[model samples]
Target: MTLLVGVDIGNSTTEACLAECGPDGPRYLGGALTSTSGVKGTADNVPGVVKVVQEALSAAGRDQHELAAVLVNEATPVISGLAMETITETVITESTMIGHNPDTPAGAGLGTGTTVAFAELGACAPGERVICVAGAGVDFEDAAAGIAAARDRGVEVTGAVVQADDANLIVNRLPTPIPVVDEVTLVEKVPLGMPAAVEVAEPGRTVRTLSNSYGIATLFDLDPDQTRLVAPVARALVGNRSAVVVRTPSGDVADRRIPAGTLTLIGEHARLPVGVDAGAEEIMATLRRVTPLADATGEAGTHVGGMLATVRDAMAETLSDTGGEQDAAIQDVLAVDTFVPQRVTGALAGEFALENAVALAAMVRTSRAPMEALAGQLRSALDVDVHVGGVEADMAVLGALTTPGTRRPLAVLDLGGGSTDAALATGDGEVHSVHLAGAGDLVTKLIDSELGLDNRDVAEDIKKNPLAKAESFFHVRMEDGTARFFDEPLPAEAFARVVVLGEGGMRPVPTRHPLEKVRRVRRSAKHKVFVVNALRALERVAPGGNLREIGFVVVLGGSALDFEIPDMIAEAVAAAGVVCGTGNVRGSEGPRNAVATGLVDEHAGRTR
Candidate 1:
């Protein structure tokens, strides 16, 4: 009996399978998995490969000296990098608006008047409509008293903007209620003596008047051009509970489309350039027009250009380290339309506007020379006969076939960290495969960008785990609206917060978004990356670009073990009348170690 170990080096992980190849056949013994040390298909992965092989051998109760050879999958190094370019920007020329949602604002309704400081209210003429602006140094009681005194003198105090968080206290003391927005961090920046409008809505409601362009036009009696200029200001205040729009002589707001540059798609037949400002749908459509894409490049001196260059340079560095050619080409690109909350410029109070952005994920394809170098390094380090195995997709399909009740005419979807690969196998022994960019890592980035989480680890946790709302100390409401009870009281910080049900424990999401909103963003991001790529990949590999031609799809890889990814892909592909589910290699390992097991199986067959 000859004992051998097969290792599969993936973008995110390394896995090994051990088996005994005798005269009769191969007997599967054990498997092991660990995080890949460095980039897959590079010399840096030698330590990870050696560790996993030793682990697999130990699990099988075999000595390293007893192993005959170590086979590794022909890993194609795929490096994926993503960049977000904002197409739409909201710019306030001269501090035109204070559109931010404070936790608490007082009263409801619109108040328009001339802006004046609280100390100057006493000097106002009777019937002179003015909005009181209270600085942080001013006491809330004194401010309220001053407003009441000014009102008694018929100095109409139509509205109030306070620097401190005392809007509620001031409004409660007023005999006549008026809109009051508080917590204006940059209250000193409010243009005094200018016409301003303050609108505060009731609890659980959004401001209406200031959020409407026509309403702002009517309040300031602006001309058509001025009204057009103020449209972006209204858009920035759409979802705020309270807002203040101050009109200065030179104040203006603009919604501008930034020049994000263009991408050049180099296909087998033609090279076409698509503008990034045209949005993701248009770019993707243009990309499809150039079928069999050979490579892609970006226009010089632009955001997209810088992004693509960064990706290429990083890949080139990795290849150069492995003694391969330094020139790297982008093999695939995935563009997604998303919204990022960017801070509005020239704002009195810090305000964020949802700007239109295009997120591009570029994948670089390298030659097999890197993997060959890695295999050589592994052989010398482990002192074992290490040989590069078959193509990853073919080996994955072979291992997937070991699933119970699976047979010929099968397909496999390998959803890895960096890319999504699809392979279709026919009964006649013909196999077709395609690799596409954008998978788990891209999805995590999308979630982080879209939700403005800015923390990849948190976004990844949200992606891998379900969410819940800590409704009470003893109970929590899950993402599916089911209540889960606990014997112990939950942490105080988790109360009334959206938390991720991670394996470690309930980790509270740091954002202020509600449970449902977070859930929607997470699911939408996954659908955009995984579901879209799944369909795109399947169509590419399916006969005649028709999914119905494929008999069955077996999902394999680390992402396949996700709590929801498999189901999402299955539901997405089911419309084509296909059978799709996660694979169980050898009816034991679930959605993992497929390539490694396939290598051993193929090796055993060759020896036989």
Candidate 2:
């Protein structure tokens, strides 16, 4: 019997399958997986490949010297890079709005008056309507006393903006309740003597008057042009429980569309140019117009240009030693429409506005020289015969066919970390495949950026696990609205907080967003990446770009292991009359080890 090992080097991991070939066929012995040492399809992967192979051989109780050959898939180095360009920005020339959700504000009504400093409240003439501005140095008790004394003199204290967290204290001491907005970090920046309006909502409610443009217009008696400019301020104030809109002589808010630059799609048939500001849908539509993309370029000295250059440069640096004649070229691009929370240009408090952005994920493809170079390195390291195996997609399809209830004319979706690959196999032994950018990593990034988590690890955990709100020490409300009871008490930090139910136990989400909001963002990010890429890949592989032509689709790779990704894809493809589900390779390995197993099966066929 001859012992052989097949290795599949993926973007994020390296997998190996060990098998023995006998008179009848090859019997699978064992398999092993480890993180890829370096970027896929490069010589840096030698160390990881060696480690995985040794593990597989050791698990199968075979010595390295007994191995006949080590076969590796024909890996086309695919590197995916992401960039986000903010198309719309909200810029306030003057400090016109303080729209932040302070945990505790006072009163529940609208108050409008001329802004007056706390020290000047005593000098205000009787019946003069004014809003009190308390500095941090003033105590809440003293400020309340001063306001009460001014009111006793007939000075109308319509509202108050406090530098400290004393809104509740001040309002409780006042005989007549008035709206009070507190926690104004940059109180000094508030324009004095200007007309301002403060509105506070009751508990468990959001501010209404200040959140509407018409409401602000009526308060300030703004003209048509002035009202148009304040629309962005109103938008920024939405969902806040308390807000303060100060109208200065030169206060201006502008929602401007930035010139993010253009992208040139180089295809086999035509070259199309698309503006980054045109949004994601337009860019993707232009990409579809030019199928079989050869390369993509961006305008010089522009955001899109810098983004594309960065992706190209990264790939070139990794493939510098591969001795390839051509430089790295962008083979595919995936554009996603998303919102990024950007700090308002001019605001008293650190308020953020959700700005429209287009996130692009580009896939760089290098020649086979890199894989050949890697093969030589592997041969030297292992001192065993190393052969570059068949096309990766074909091998994956072959491995997927081993799954029960699978047969000819089957399609496979290899959803990995960096790219989404699709392969269609027919009875005549012909395989059609396409590789596209954007997969699990992109989804994680989207979740990270959209939710403003700024942490990939936390976003990944949220992507992989279900979320829950800790209702009590012993019970938690799950994302699906079901209650889960724990025998032991939960962590104190998780009480009344949104937590992720991962294998390592409950991890509290650091964001102040509620459980439902986080869950919505997570699911939306998944749907945008996996479900969209699945359909895009299938259409390119299916005959005449018709998904209906494909009968069965077997999902493979790391992303297939996600709890909700497979179901989302299945639901999406069902509309086209396609049966889709996660693949259980060999009826034992679930959605994994397909490419490695296929490499072994192909070798066994050739030897026979």
TM-score per candidate, in order?
A: 0.97, 0.96
Worst 10 residues of 1 by lDDT: 318-327
Candidate 2, residues 357-471, lDDT tens digits: the string is: 8888999776664677899999999999998979998899999999998887889999988889999997788999988999998899889988888998899999999999999
What's the lDDT for all of these models?
0.89, 0.90
Q: Residues 210-278, candidate 1: write the lDDT tens digits.
A: 999999999999999989989988888888999999999998888998889989999999899999988
Best by TM-score: 1
Listed per model in order, the count of residue pairs whose N, CA or C atoms clash below 3 Å is 0, 0
Q: Any idea what lDDT model 2 has?
A: 0.90
Give the residue spans of candidate 2 off by over 4 A. 321-325
Top-lDDT candidate index: 2
In angstroms, give how far residue 58 of model 2 lies from its true place: 2.5
Least well predicted 10-residue stretch by lDDT in candidate 2: 318-327
Q: Which pairs of residues collide in model 1?
A: none
All predictions: root-mean-square deviation over Cα?
1.5, 1.7
